[model samples]
Target: MIGYLVLALLGLFVVAFYAGHRRAVASVEGDVARLHSRPSQHGLYLALLSCVPALLLLVLWSLVTPAIEASIVRARFAAEVAEMSLPQVQAFIRDARAIAFGGIAGFPDETKEAAAALFGTLHGWSVRIAVVLSLALAAAGYLYGIARIAPAFRARHMVERTVRGFLILCSVVAILTTIGIVLSLIFESLRFFQQVPIYKFLFGTHWSPQSAFTGAGAEEGAVNTDIFGAVPLFAGTLLITVIAMLVAAPVGLMSAIYLSDYASRRVRAVAKPMLEILAGIPTVVYGFFAALTVAPFFRRSGEALGLDVASESALAAGVVMGIMIIPFVSSLSDDVINAVPQSLRDGSAGLGATKSETIRKVVLPAALPGIVSALLLAVSRAIGETMIVVMAAGLAANLTINPVEAVTTVTVQIVTLLVGDQEFDSAKTLAAFALGLVLFCATLALNIIALRVVKKYREQYE
Candidate 1:
């Protein structure tokens, strides 16, 4: 119904725009420059004046209507629901609303049926009232705006102001959303810490969150108190990320240098896209490749060396993840390196430097900041990866630096904790948020370091 009303408002906007443009043109005798604003501006002003109020009302109605309906329904059946708990009454109201909307009630009752009928009647009346009020308001606003559409009216200025406000609103919304997410994570993590000691979660060397909620009517003692330690998850995540960077950084950097300087235009044209194809492939496909092919190969190679490698090991996941991130490092670094001033290379050559020496000393120094930023981006990508780790590195929170061992990352554990149906208030569930908070912090710190490094190198280059 609100959708229909919004569509109707859109139709009215078209009408208002045409009407206002025609009136403005006639008022100015088609000499638009003489007027303070153009016919288009006049039309836009009319449309906004006619539609914005009605749209706002519709939004307000949508927000307030449910609570109003719930209250009225509760009052209508107050005696019948007097003995019910607040949750029960709320459930009944919800069921009644569902029934009114043509859904079958799962638990039917006379009071609920009565309330549902009352809801249908009240909702119909509310819709009728809202329609009349919105249409009348739109009509009044349309007429008011048209009356004010004089030759000297500053309609363009008004539209610009509205546009500015809209942009600010968008920015504010994005900022607030980020703040809300951080606050929610912090609040949930605090609740988790209340149940599980923060020291144990952060510094302890064990992890088995399942023990947190193992049996019915369990006490804190039943929760393997030693198991909530997150050091292993952090260690695994870092170890995998390190391996990925070790693979990606040198190879990707060298590839970028080759494409940017060494390769012929024809070779670059073909090779760049082929190399970037790695980025386009889905991570799940990589995971499948890692699990089926890479892990087995690593196992066999390790066996040949008599090195007892796990079938699913950090080496397999990290290597595959590194392959996935290579294109990011290659493509971004290539672009950044290409952006370096050709004058620097020419200056180095003029000073009797070889091509390789000029590239190494002049071009690389200038492009170092962007290259560092690219590597950091690739590292973040590697850290947040889940499927590749889950499939190739089995979900064991091993605190070892050994790349041949099975290990799970923080992201994998966060997904594992929140995957199934579970109580949100439970320590087990809230631990996901704690892990998320830690992960967010780690990523944030990496970004800060990247920014600082970029700033320092950029200053030196400048």
Candidate 2:
């Protein structure tokens, strides 16, 4: 609530700043020395100065407050719980926190009262301090800008630079988040490798994570600990991705071509968005469609052909996933194909080439980079997709190449490993992180290769 108030205050300040600057500029005109910027630029300069610094501080405060409060709470309890074992103390702290935050109840009366008092005081003070500090900074900046609104202020250029920097910071934050996730996955995978050999995980033929917790004395040196082969999951993921690409690529590309090259303007206007409507459908809907409808149809069809087929078949899941990816491929490819210079098409036509020949040899080749990028993007989506596979693809990790067989992908395994009740410290659960690391690396490699391919294709046109 305080954050919203701060934003509201900042917005009001901007409006005031703009109004004041415009009034000042209109009144002064050419009577005084030349103004450093236009009236609007001067307003923007004041507005940015009033908001940016305070917003930055508010963001920093928000991020650090939780850690600080947690530390304080831990310190308060440390002496009281010192006699307890580390694990027990930790558990107690967790329970106390839950009670304090209204997540759970049934704490000791004294502990609950103390926790409530502490949390209320800290939270109230934190919010008050944040609001006070931000308001003060904004007021100061606003006043300074107002005072400097004389003809000498270089407001426009400074505001532009500040806005550019702000945008850059936002982009950097997104990139940094991706980097952090990849690093976390790498670290957890390293921990997993400590328990199971990397070679066994990568190359072994059998993959039964449930076996890691088997037997009466499985905690001791288990015989089957080294059987964590990822071949089947990898193969299944690849097969599904390939099948999806096969379904998406030709259909999406041809759709793009028709929209860009052949469709009448009115037809294109109606059909483009209609086709893109496929993208809006949720994956969960697709999941049920695959599981309830597609899988049964496949099974019945296979039975008719006198062939053995699993009710939850890979073909069913892969085909559904492919359909899900069609919009991504078509939309991206369409934009890229349209972006190709019309001069190239015109030049081709002047050389006695037919429209189909011009498109085939000229437009498609030129737009190949974007098409490859779109396909790679779709491949990444297929690899990471969870819900459809979880529902349609069976959980059995069969190490086979047959598309008709029941197969599981990495995401399915990850979902199963982490779902329901599970210990986070167990090998079974930790294997999900290991799988995530592999998936991340695989997708990153695909994107890089795709980017390179696109760049090379662009160079040919250049």
lDDT of each: 0.91, 0.84
- Per-residue CA lDDT of model 2 for 339-438, tens digit only, reads 8999999999999999999999999888888898999988998999988888888899998878888899999999888889887767777899999999
Once fitted onto the true fold, the runs of candidate 2 whose alpha carbons sit more than 4 angstroms away are 1-4, 26-33, 67-79, 85-101, 106-108, 215-223, 339-353, 357-370, 420-424
Quality of model 1 by C-alpha lDDT: 0.91
Highest lDDT model number = 1
Candidate 2 contains a number of clashing pairs equal to: 0
Candidate 1 residue lDDT tens string, 66-98: 899889989888999899999888889989999
Model 1 backbone overlap count: 0
**Structure candidate 2, residue pairs in collision:** none
